[model samples]
Target: MKIYLLYTGGTVGSVGKPLGPLAGPRFVDAFRANVETIITSQLPGTTINYDYFTPTLDSTNMQPADWVRIAQKVLSNYKKNDAFLVLHGTDTMAWTSSALSFLLPGISKPLFVTGSQLPLFFEQDESYTLLFNTDALRNVLGAIQFMTFAIPEVALYFADTLYRGNRVIKSNAREFTAFSSSNYPALGRYGVLPVLNERLVRPAPSTNALNNHIQKVAADLNIIMENINRSSVIQFLLFPAYYDRTSGDSLIVSMLTQLSRVNPPLRGIVFESFGEGNIPDFASMQALLMDLSTSGIILVDCTQVYAGDVNYGAYATGAWLKGAGVISGYDMTPVAALAKLVIQLARDPSSPKDEIQKAMSTDLAGEMVIL
Candidate 1:
């Protein structure tokens, strides 16, 4: 079996020496020599191919477009390899992995993504040296088939636990245990024997080749957090437990009012609602939110809760909000919803205001729950 190692710049591939507080290590010829030596010595008979990105990048510099590139690279190589391994930077690994799972729909091979906390060039550890070897990976291939890879979807493997990418959030900046999937458990543990957790993995879809089955169409999603331009599109980040507070109410109004004043009028608003879709029933809050919806801005009732389905209009308060023009957000996360809204808004600024309502409810990137 041939394993292709696609290296996109990250700490794992970075080589630089510190110069006081601002200095970074440079990737010298010795760095490559060390890596090659370790691979050659540890995996005696295995064949491994290495490719570097045009220009290495720090994990902080990662974007969705970068993910598109990585996915394309894998798709391009689907015919020649039995399985693939990606050495990625941990910073945005979860986001990239999640995007890949969506972009590459029917992946059938072991597309394992791993990287060390310390660069192989800078560190000296048995784990990094041993794990980087083809032998370390070859031993696990007998049991890692298409079905096993599907479980936990595209996962982030670090510090022992393997977590589903979409569910994982970056919780640390310096530690090896940087990624965590709080809503879900590790898909499987990696130790003496990698235990397969069938329940967590999704069954493979019907497809001839994993590469050709991907949805090549990429979404033009935007993640608006601080940049609320004078554009007609606006979304409010609402936490359920705090939606009742005067502060939350004010934020909602400020965002709505600001958008309404923009040229061509605002398109919609995504209310990042709290747990299982509950919101404050205060008349002031209801009127303010409903007024924007009635005025043609889409009001998406997204849940702030990390897990579970959002039951919009389930309670009297929820029903009142829904009746007043709020659409159930279902189970979309704030980041996903915001991105979806940006995509929709960009496609058609004058989109039948109902588009936001619809997109937020749909399961794009497996980021939302249908039920």
Candidate 2:
């Protein structure tokens, strides 16, 4: 099996920054050598090649431009590889994976984006080349086995669980098991072999001589990215009652007013409401949301709750938001909502506002639990 590795840099590509106890060898070099050694000795006949991006990025500093660059890289190699693997950083790995879920459409191959909590070189076991870091090695190896299958999704393989890229969030920063799919079950888990949950995977895209689905989607993204203004999308959170008591109307109004002043105007905003998408039914708050709708701002209502769907119409507090033309965010994580908005806005399709609303509620990238 052939796999193309895109090392976009993360802790996986780093060997600690220069400091008293941190300085060391570049991780890309060490990881490359170990990977080659493992393939030659342990998995004969399997080929894995990689490209380390220049000036590798730390996920903490990642951006939309970086996301687009990765999309371009994947498309560049799509025609030549059986599957693709991305070595990304845990900090923004979920976002990158989610973003790619939107960008790469109609794919019929496995694309696994994974990284480790500890650097791959930290494994206590010293005799192994690739198994030096148990968790890191397990994920990479599991990803390898997945590459040999027909799983057609952008999955984040972390710890021992495989989550749909858009459905996972970095739940812990200090643990080896750093991510979790709170609203959804994992696509599968890694064990003696990669046990896939067949029901969780999206159907493979159909292709015939008259159509090369992957190529068409890539071209569509290229055209869309060219027109997308990544900076124009905004995200705002509704604070607790104290915020409203302190000056809620002015606070929310000022935020949107400033957004309106932006050169190209605000394209969309993901409004993080309270539990179950609830927000004060204050007249001023209602007015602001109505204003946003009239201003053609795409407002998507999401919950700040950790693991449940947002149903604005279920309660009276949320009813006005639904009436004000805000789209319910369902069970999407904030990170997924933002990244999905960026991708959807980039496309700049006709009837932009309606399109954004539809895309948010619709499972374009399986980023949310709509039911």
Candidate 3:
């Protein structure tokens, strides 16, 4: 089978140090040198085609433009390949995968985003030297096999678990299982062999006409247009856990004041509020939010808690904020909430404001977990 591999440098391709993750000089060649035996010996006849970003940046420094590049890259070669695999950094891999879910809804082929917390080529000790990690190499190889199953929706595969892309999150930094899909079950799991829970997987649209329609919608977004920008959304997270009475209100006031001053106004917002969706109730916070909402900023909230969906009227503290046009993000990850908003806002033919709101609330890509 043929697959398109996108290598946006990260721990996956590194040997060690400052030049390691960035693909400085000839890191790709070095990485291939390390894993060539396994790729050829175990995964015998698979034809893998790869593309490396011109100047790969650490995922920590991953930007909005990077997401656009990734989407465009996939679209450019969508018809030529049977499947796609993205070798991304663990740091912002979930964020990129989440963005891709909205960017390519009803995707026709299996698209898997995979990475290693411990570098697959090699690792580092106290002196910043290369120490090869075979376990990571195994994980990468295992994931490659899984991608051939024709899984339709975008998903992230790591640590023996394949999760819905938008549902997954990077929950750990130092552990082998560095990711989690708290709100949704994994689409597949790997043991001696891959076990796919097809019931959980969203099937691709059966008709090619439907598939082409979806692809055309995405293609329209990539066309360059004057006075238009795709990255026209913002996000805010209200940290109730670390706030005092005075700081909370004052902080909210300052943040709102700054948001109002942004020129041309934002298209949408991912407002991450407290447990079960509770935003601050200070008079200034309420007033400013109402103004932004009326200004047509589509504000939506996901919870800071790991498990529950957002329930707006559970308490009085945040009830007033609802009237300000805040929509619940249900059980979506923060990255998903933001990415989806940016996507619908940028949709071509100028997706109506109400239609965008309706789309966000609906489960277009198995992102929403209805309770």
Candidate 4:
């Protein structure tokens, strides 16, 4: 089987004491000399092809344009390769994976994203050597094995489990199991053998359907690229604050109102609100939010709690947000919500506020539960 490996630098490809990413060509060479040897010996007849971004970026520096570039490369090479593996930074891997799910809907082949907390190789006497004790090699190998299953979704493989990409979040910074999918079950698990939860995997689309999906994606991408520069979407985390006793002005209100007045005009916001999507009912705060909604800003309310769905009407505090035009982001991680909003706004800058709200509430790529 043939697999296309796209190494867009991350912790897995870094070296040196300070942990800097290796150049694309250098990492590719080291990968072929080391990891490639082991894979070929164990699984003969596996052909691995390589590609990478120029001047590799840390995951922290990744942007929407970078995501567009990655999607374009994968779609252009979709027909020739049997499956695709992306070596990405654990920091924003979920966002990239989630964006890919929307960008390449109904993908028929396996596409896995993974990275490690530790580098795959260590520098010894000015030379790079394999670091067998690290999780980097293990995760990559696991992804390689899982690809043979032909799982037809964009998934993230880390540690010993494979999860639906959009459902995952970075829950741990120091451990090898850095990702967790609180609302969705594992797509597969790696133990003595790689076992798949076949029922959860999406069925591969028919040839005609797949081709049509690709055409739509290509067309949408052009629109996204054209509007991406003007797309201004953000995530706002709520906290306890009150209207100033003396000034009668709320910090929350001031900040959001100022944001709304910026050049691009803050097209959308994902409010990381309190339990069950509740927010403080400060009058000025409520008024500013209502004004923003009336002015065509797409507002989404997502829960700050880690593992629960957003229920806007369950409590009185949350009801006002819904009444003011905020849509519920049911069980979607903040990362998924932010990426989805950005993609939707970029795909159609002039989309009506209600239309954008509907797109956020709907489960386009298994990112959220509608119920």
Identify the leading candidate in terms of lDDT: 4
Compared with the true structure, what per-residue lDDT tens digits does model 1 show for residues 65-90? 56667766776776677666666777
Candidate 4 segments exceeding 4 Å error: 244-248
Residues 36-149, model 3: lDDT tens digits: 556667667777677878787678878766777787788787878888888888888988899887776558788888878776654334223234453466667777878768
lDDT pick, better of 3 and 4: 4
lDDT of each: 0.57, 0.75, 0.74, 0.86
Worst 10 residues of 3 by lDDT: 122-131
Best by TM-score: 4
For model 1, the run of ten residues with the poorest summed lDDT: 19-28
TM-score of 4: 0.96
The sequence of per-residue lDDT tens digits that candidate 4 reaches over residues 1-371 is: 79889989989998886787888888998899889988877778999989998878789889987888888878877888989999998889999998888778778888899999999998777578999999999999999999888878999999999999889889999889899888889999999999999998777777634445666778878888788779588889998876764465987887888788777668988999999999877677777788888988888988878889888668888888877878889899888998888898998888887788888989888898887
**TM match of model 1 to true structure:** 0.66
> What's the CA error at residue 177 for candidate 4, in Å?
1.0
Candidate 2 vs. true structure, TM-score:
0.88
Q: Residue 350's C-alpha lDDT in candidate 1? A: 52
